[model samples]
Target: MATSSSRIGARLLFGIVLLFPLTYANDNAQFPYALTFGSSTLTASWFTKSEGIKAIQFPVDSKYRAYFEDALASFGKRIMRRGEWHVMAGDELVPAPPDTHNEDTAVSLFRDAAQQVSRNLSATLGFEPTYAALTLSSVFNQSSTKAATDAIFPNGMGFIHSIKSLNKVAPAACVAHRLDLCGNLGRTPAECADKDSISNLILVLEYEKEYLYVDLVFVYSEYRTFPSVGHEMLREFGEANREKLLKSMSTYDYNRKLHQTLNAFIESLVERQLIVRVDIRAIVVAGGASATAIAQLRKLAHNAVGNGVVKVVDEIDPGLATAHGAAANNGENDEEIERAAEDENIDDDPQSGDPKETCNNDAIEYIFDEQQPQTFDGDKMKEMYYDKDAWVSGFNSLMMECTKLYIFADKYSIPQLRDDITSALVGHSHGWGWWPDPDIDIIELVYNNLPSSSGLIRLLVLFTAYSWSSSPNVIAWKDRFRGFHPEYLLDVLFAQAQLLENEIHGEGGIPYDGMLNSCVVHEHLELGEEECRERLAKHSYIFASLLSACQAANA
Candidate 1:
């Protein structure tokens, strides 16, 4: 009876299972084959398997999948074609080629010139131009000797062209001292090499496209030579006369000691103009030796160039020997820098062009108040080389010098010197007003050529912004704007926006005043309130419009 009952129950269960068949269901099965979602729809295959595999495996639902795929393909095609809906169409816009200056070539030529100068020093005793190509390239990009802008180009631009020497010989005083020790003792300049005389090489570089020569004198501080003319003068005038004699002796020795060297160098430009015609600028003296020597050399250089024309430069260099090595291997302070300050022009020289024009003391009346500590202390000429305000008055005249110094700093890895120069440039611009008609070409050249990491780029941009803001007239403004590199100009525009944004958002900020008054802009538009407002409005629109135009043009 139990077996029969079990069979009957099994049969009833089978019947019930057959009537209501159980099936397994996946959650993804209910997901639409293609569900619309904005422009792009999600499909089961898109979320699950790739479209290619889904197409092959699931051919039955091809209609819905095809609809979704066709829509996606059309959308992609529309995006690639030219249309108002797309941000951009077709391929990316090509960028314009960068306008790279011939700086690499210029740097190469300059380095070669320095090497030639170094090599020729041993063989020649004159003002020899070692590199013929040194002066081949025009310093000014557009101007020449006849061009009006030619006068604006700074000399040298940091190139060593001509080399002149203050001959190698024993001092007359040294010879005299030797004679006193042993009678009838005489040493010729050749025999007494490096004995009593130190043959200092004065490199004549191009300063403001003009040659800058250092008129130096070598003095003997030892025992006196027997009754020399310089000594006789010294006896008559005391200390002042003594300086005059030393100055006189320097010129005499230059001609006497380096006669052979000078003769050899006379074949080129050195002969025609520098030596024969004497058509030159002021001679300079580098300070750093004994105070007496500096005073004597300064007087001598002044006398040689004439009192009004001569100038003194600080001992900014760390000896030519270190520079020489630096030129070869781009290395750093193999040695410490020795400071030598160049004081102001000597006052009350009887031989001066204008005796009344002399300053009683040698103190440099620093152009800007920033250079207050530059007072001359007795005989010591201790003007700081890195003083920002020191260059305020002669900003334009000193640009080339600063450039050379920067390059020198770069070659020798002198970060402090470079930083100092950067500070000086900043002070110079601020002192003279933000946009005081700077030489944009030179600044551009420097900006383009300097190392990318240099701080000079920022300074250049700041000045350029000032120039742009303060453009006096339409033509001037257009020229200045067009001068910058497109990328750099964009950067400046962005920077200006940020500055305005900061000022507008900061404490005591001007509500809705996005444009702050730049020194250049304020000075240029010195007008009534209404006129200034109108002018500023126009400038803002024009400048904003120009940025887009520049981008398009560059593209």
Candidate 2:
């Protein structure tokens, strides 16, 4: 009795229903395993819902270790050493025959080694896992690497890689950024820029079953031990200077290029609406140089994005993470599984209010003295307690007091008090003297007590940046800069750059006067603009002259 279209729709629905169980069955039957190809070792892992995860290392017998080491040595000696000067041409390097031939041979040798390891793993497990995944070290060229992997695992899922596996293990709504810091061969063009250079070298040598720091020097294209170079440097230059040197090295061209690559990838993903910035939660570091790479990448990420939330996960067994991650990627839907578990634990009762609501609706009650009955009563009370004249006489004590109050307010969850203290402190910083400088104590207090996102912190940084030229105290704090939070220092540098940029463009310099605008430092909570303005009207007289100057400058 149904129409032709309705009959077609019914048939399609029935077909989908019938196929659903078959698809699920296939997923259940899938026993995915992964093998990670590394310079010194081969790592394999398999995952099953019932069994969880099982990982094994190849070259179980010490003699077999030579095979992997020789393959890697050949890759470095033949491909990397020669490919350094070669040019890329549409996925093919020019001067093709010899270099290309060596590259293929190197990849094949590596693959053969991996296959032997896989066979051993399969034999040990009794049944071989058919759905296999493979992840290669950064030294392997992606185009050639894919061919090698395909050959190793003919029925492989090409899209499943270590990074995807890392994402699977990471917390929800977060993705992983892989930073492979290999030993011999530099992977990308950026890493290859300074091949085997000692300019910014860091090494961890395996000796007597313990990893020890190795400082080496490159003399006439050969590496030689510098012999306690780090210790000597520390003794000569002191810990502070050594730390500074290390920090500077983190931004070297190789690391800079890596950071830029990561930034570009993140921005592209954002542009494509694939992921937001917050979704980039972890930088999974792998390889022999992981310890060095993590420190450098942490600094770079902090500089690039202030890195408040992003974590740098140290993969102790470097290549094993990739193997385990790949094995976890089988036909299973990790997200869906997690979602289902979360749903099962969720309460049936609806939440009292939207948890994500940004605005605090609780009314902030400001009780005024009945005898005084003034609109600016709160301001007057703050002035009386902190003493405005004392701040003009010597701002240190007042600054400290205000900072403590701000910290207290933050602790007690009093946004209104925090806002009031912020406005008062900023106004005083401008009016106290020509170049009123906050000392190291105040800097430490704000940074230590409040989070980096605090407006008060931003205000203090801006004030420091604008006043640095005239403020001798701030200039003198250079020695103590290392003690300051890295994020705080980065913020200050950015603030200074912004002020300089404003001057360069003939923007007539930063409007320090504009900072007097109460609303700039005020927290309105749930109040509408009109309501916020009405509330702020009471304290408007406090910065009337400064606000007038700001308005005139803008006009």
Candidate 3:
């Protein structure tokens, strides 16, 4: 027994040595904790729950179990014993795939579906298969001909999911990096075999030479259970019968909510000439679905856009397809996704209520005579206009236009245009003689439209913070605060903290206007700078307290 234990320990140590490199590699890689669906981004913690066998049934008194438990403890892993199950069993548990208040799941499904379609199309057309998930816009806005759309190149290498094989993306061989289980917790090599337990729906696409499989999963509310096992059945409804079903919503004997969601989306696309036709072979319903529910969905899908035969299968792990597929393809950049959306035109803009164009300002507009007139030739170009109001207006307009252009470029995969616009914004901010200060209105406009990832957004925030620090009266601080997103506010505060910490002095030791204005904002409802001082002090204290609590629990 002693020799056997020594052998086990030796093997465990060997496994650890083999695992280090994988751990180091994945330590820097980012996982998809949040998914974007239309305008909303939903958090998905379940997608990344430490990859290991949870709730493994082991003998309560087995000496091997003790050894494994000790190993897990060394790695800071908790083991749920049989007795603990009794305690936890009584506790009300939230269902799997927690966040689903918005249309995130639906959008995720559509995005993956569209990408699969694009891949098939690429193969058919003899183009390189793209790995990126298409944006909602790209699916709807796809050009009528390959010749027209094919001219534009793919933005960058995007994340791709091996629908048929999760291991292709996750590489089950790297289980050591996935979880620190102290060399698989003393389990034998046979015991640690890949379970392939995750639920997923397989989508098979037939190409000329071979078949491609696209696995999918839907994130549905576990709380919303089907009323009966096989009570309701829904058939496909097309454009011809859509109005009748929508108008008589009360008479519908199906999952009306799900039906309407799909109905509205398909209707919107078809109305805009985006989705002319769908050749969907299968629409598998999985994850907390019953026979009746699956049938009902099939009917709903049929009625919504039922042009041809669409089969609906009831399968397990439908959600796995989305979660695993997304995790596999998490490395895709924003531009590739945007281009996909632009081409598809599935995701509509709320403000514009139209398809976002892939082409940039220059591409859309023709220079009839580029050399004819050199406007503001030589002498006039050098005249530095210091009109604060004019500068503010012109720069504000430029930012707004750039904001649009930048978003356009990002969305349509026009990297060149995006880079040009970013350069222009940065150059204009630094080089131009007059400091262009955008007032509350312009600030709000950019904040609302531009994504946090945008370079322009960062520049605007820094400039605004500095402007507020330099001269509080340059912009209406109070009004601006009312419209600023919480994220924007937090970013500004973080910037302010960094600026103050660096102690970069202005003309004097006096506090800069940006930091001062930030302090003033915090100091409101308090005497002098009391609130501001408390905020700075409390930030660190609060974080420390939380960390201590986490540590205590771990211990």
- The TM-score, computed over Cα atoms with residue i paired to residue i, of candidate 3 is 0.24
Best by TM-score: 2
Candidate 1 residues lying further than 4 Å off, grouped into runs, are 1-394, 430-435, 467-475, 507-555
Tens-digit lDDT string for candidate 1 (1-555): 000110021111111111111221121121112100111111111011111101001111333234323432332222211111222234753322322223343344333333333343222222222211011111222111112111111232111111110111112112211222211222345634544332121222111111111222222112111111110001112233434555767746643333333223332434433232132222222211334444444444434433242233322221111111111111011001011112433343322233322111112221122222223232222132112343322344445445644654554444434544554444343332333334555566666667645655555555555455434653556666686666566756765665567566763322222122322212221243344344333322222222212222221
For residues 1-555, could you state the per-residue lDDT of candidate 2 as single tens digits?
001110011111111111213333333334655665544456565554544444555542343345333433333233222213344566765543343335455456656766676576445444444534566543344344645555664433333222122211111001111222222212345634554432222111211111211111111111111111121001112223334455666546555664574455455545865344543333443333344444564465544443354444443333244454455543233334346448755322212222211111111122211122223344543443223444233345445555665675565455655665655555443332233455677788888889887767877777667667445766578878877777778988887776666667745335532333444555555343454454444433323322222222221
lDDT (Cα) of model 2: 0.42
lDDT of each: 0.29, 0.42, 0.32
Q: Write the per-residue lDDT of candidate 3 for residues 1-555, one digit (tens) a residue.
A: 000110021111111111223442232122322121111111121122234111000111233223223322222112122112111224643222321222343333434433443443233333333332221111111111111112111221122221111212111111111211212223234533432221111111100001111122111011100111011112133222333556767545425665575656555545765334342334433221233333454576666546464444332232122222333333322334345558875433212233222111111111112122123223332332333344345445545545654554454444433443443443333333233554555566556766676655666666656655546563555674766566777777777666675566443322443212222222122223443333333222222222222222221
Number of clashing residue pairs in every model?
Answer: 12, 0, 38
Minimum summed lDDT over a 10-residue window in model 3 is located at 220-229
lDDT of 1: 0.29
